[model samples]
Target: MERWKINLIVLWLGQFMVMSGMTMIIPFLPLYIQEMGIHDPHEVAVWAGLIFAANFVSSFIFQPIWGGLADRFGRKVMLLRSGFGMAFVMMFMGMAATPLHLLLLRLANGVISGFMPAAVALVSANTPRERMGFAMGTLQSGSVAGTILGPLFGGVLAEWVGFRPIFYITGGLLFAASVLAAFLVKEKFDIEQAKTRPKMSVFSGFRELIRIRQLPALYSVTFLIQFSILSSMPLIPLFVQELHGSGQLLAFYAGLVGSVTGFSNMIASPLLGRLGDRLGSQRILAIALIGTGLAFIPQAFVTNIWQLLASRFLLGVFMGGLLPSVQTLIRQYTPSGMESRAYSFNTSALALGNMLGPVIGGAVSGLIGIRGIFMTAAVLLLLNALWVRLSLFPRNQVQKTGS
Candidate 1:
């Protein structure tokens, strides 16, 4: 296989490990807190929200810093840093003795948790432009598969060996990704560019991105894509519970509801990627945005597990296309020497969505009901679709940048 292809595969698995490790603790987060001596349900909920948000808070602040480093040093170095750093931090999280300790460790985790986007940057930097959509699509499948399965795996492993062990296992997998990346991933790096690149402060780089007409829109697409999808995440289990009532099998069914979309997403990603390559990424992205917006409405009104599963599966088909198109658009618009920086900033935008999506979703559910959040998510995605139409396809062309 070609070197770029090799890097794509390595980074695909790396992204999977990164996502899987990050998500594996979710199934039992509150339980783990209880183990740490927090018995009050409301206090557990508060701590859980705080600890989860801590990761994104620190990650949002640090992603641009890492991006600049990736451009200056090499994308691989950043990948290894995130991979190994996450491994150590996840292990530390497993060893937390108190909610404060877990919260602090989760904060530390955000500082090191750019591995997935870093891997995306590495593959984006290395892949040929024509194949960018397909490569990203394929790569996304891995992470999506991991995300879909992570909760299921977490539940099973928690039942079998307990929650702390899940963290250790997740940490081991990330460490293994570091080893694989160190040994197998290769970049046709420009040492001269690294040495000669002007010192661009992160603030100036943000300003510079704003100077580019399409970049901010592309960044918004990145943010909205994450925001729309994650807005449904914190409420899925509750929705499932509402559909079927609480039982011994509630967790299992809830996980199944979550995993099914990932199944369709993993299947549709590469196909939509190739479709985007042939049909124009912006056009397909528009289709996906609207399609996903529509998909959420059916999910909002589902009366049974089958109906919800079908709605989510449909949602997954369009969801598969959104990010690859966004990444392709990013590749088209970014300048030659700043691939890592743009992706890193884009990752920051994604982190911001993650930081806020669940909070907003939680608020919607609290005020309305379980199904109401899905309606809110649908409206948000529809608005985002309009933004894409206005911002990206203004003249029916993604004005080719001077790369």
Candidate 2:
């Protein structure tokens, strides 16, 4: 097997473990706060929100710094740094005696979190350009699959072994992933070339990359893709309640509604990526954006949980095309020696989207209600599609077909 293929397989598993470990706390975060002697429901809610947001906030700020280092040092080293750093932090989180300690630990975890972006950089740098779409799509599938199953596994383990022990288990998973990467993942990095590369500060590197044609637009698309999809997530349970009524099965139905989209997304990501490789990633991105926008409309008006689930599933299928295409575009446009920095900037956009999505969603729901949030997201995505068409597709440039 080729070296790139080996890195892809190992990094795919590493990405899965990293994402899974990070999300495993989602199901019991609030419960953990409550256990920390927080009796008031409102206090628990506030602490949970703060603790959750802490990671994204730190990650958004530090991603570029790490990206610069990855460009100078090596992507595999950065990956190991994040994987092991997160492992130790997660284990210590199990030992946290107070909410403050947990909050600080989450912040530290965010600072050390670069495993996914580093994995993408390594794979992108090593893979054949013609197969970039397939590799990216395959890599994305692993991350999405982990995200879809993490909460489920976490919830079950939390019930069986309690909250703190779940943290220890998550830590163990991360450590094992790091060990695999250490032994198995290979990167053909030119150390002398990397050393001789011109040095630039983080912000300057970001500015230099942003000057590349089509990159800023691609970054915006990345942000909008995440913002549009995640903006409605927090309100799903409320929307489900409105459709199904508050019943004993509400939690089960809510989980189903949430997981169904990811299930379809996991299936569609690689298939659509392969299609993009043939049909042109720009074309697939345009169609997926339109499809996703239209899919949100049905969710806004769904009269029952089943209708909502179907709509979300359809949305997921289209969504599978968005990020991989964007990443491929980024790789195509970025100059040699700055791929990691470019990907890191993209990661920053993603972190911003993750951080702001729920806050804005909650605020929007308060103003226009949950249905209005859906409509707003649909409009934003549709407008994003127009932006892509105008900025990315030149009138004279013909779309590239198969490799």
Candidate 3:
């Protein structure tokens, strides 16, 4: 096998472990806060929200800094730094005695969390241009698969071994992933060329990258894709309750509703990516955005859980096409020496979306109700689709940039 192929495979597994480890705590986060002696239900809810957002807040600030370093040092080194740093921090999370300690550790984890972006940068830097779409799509599948399964595994392990021990297991998984990358992943970074390249401060680099024509639009698309999808996620369980009523099976049905989209997303990612490679990433992105926007409409009106599940599954198929196409477009638009920086900025955009999505979702749900939140997301996505068509697909630019 080619070296890039080997790197892709190794990094795919690494991404899977990283995503799985990061998400494993979600199922028990509020419960863990309660264990820390926060007896009031309202206080537990507040702490849980703070602890969860801490990671994304810090990650949004730091991703570009790490991206600059990846351009100067090497993507693989950044990957290892994040993988190892997250491993140790996650383990210590198991030992946290207070909600404050846990919140601080989550912040530290966010600061150290560059594994996914670094993996994408490394694979993007090394893979053949023609194969970029397929590679990115395949890589996305691994992360989605992990996302779909992580909570399930975490929920089960929480029952069997309790919450703190699940943290230790998650830490072990991250460590094992780092060790695997240390031995297996290969990068052909040119040390002397990197050393000779002109240096730019983090802010300067951000400005320089944004000046590129298509990049800012692509970054906006990245933010919107995440924002639109994640905004409805926090309300899904409540919506499920509205459709199904209270029962012993409520949790099971909620989990099913949550994971079904990811299941279809995992299946569709690589297929859509391959199609993007043949046609045009810009074209696929437009169609996917429109499809995703239309998919959200049904969720708003669904009278039962089965209708909601089917709508979510359809939404996932379009969701799979969104990010990989954006990544591919970023690569095509970025200059040779700045690929890592561009990807890092994109990751920051994504982190910003992650941080804001649930907050905005909760606020919107309060004002408009849960079903209306779905309708609002659908409208925003449809507007974004029109934005993509106007900003990214000018006929002359399409001919100039190629598919």
Q: Pick the candidate with the highest TM-score.
A: 2
Summarize candidate 3's per-residue lDDT along 1-403 as a digit string, tens digits: 9988998888888888888887888888999998989989899989999998899899999999999999999999999999999999999999999999999999999999999889999999889988888999999999998887788888899999999998899899889989999998989899789989999898999899878767888888888877877888888888899999998899989989988999999999999999999998998999999999899998889999899999999999999999999999998989888888899999999988898888898887878887887888889888988777777787687567555
Give residue 360's lDDT in candidate 1 (0 to 100): 78
- Model 3 stretches with alpha carbons more than 4 Å out: 397-403
Give the per-residue Cα lDDT of candidate 3 at 44: 92
Q: Compute each candidate's TM-score over C-alphas.
A: 0.93, 0.97, 0.96
How much is 38 displaced in model 2, in angstroms? Answer: 0.9
Sort by lDDT, best first: what order? 3, 2, 1
Candidate 1 residue lDDT tens string, 172-214: 9889889989999998788777879798999999898778877
Candidate 2 minimal-lDDT segment of 10 residues: 394-403
lDDT of each: 0.85, 0.88, 0.89
TM-score of 2: 0.97
Clashing residue pairs in candidate 1 (N, C-alpha, C atoms within 3 angstroms)? none
| Candidate 2 lDDT tens digits, 167-238 | 898899899989999999988788789989999899899889878768888888878877877888888888
Residue pairs clashing in model 2 are: none
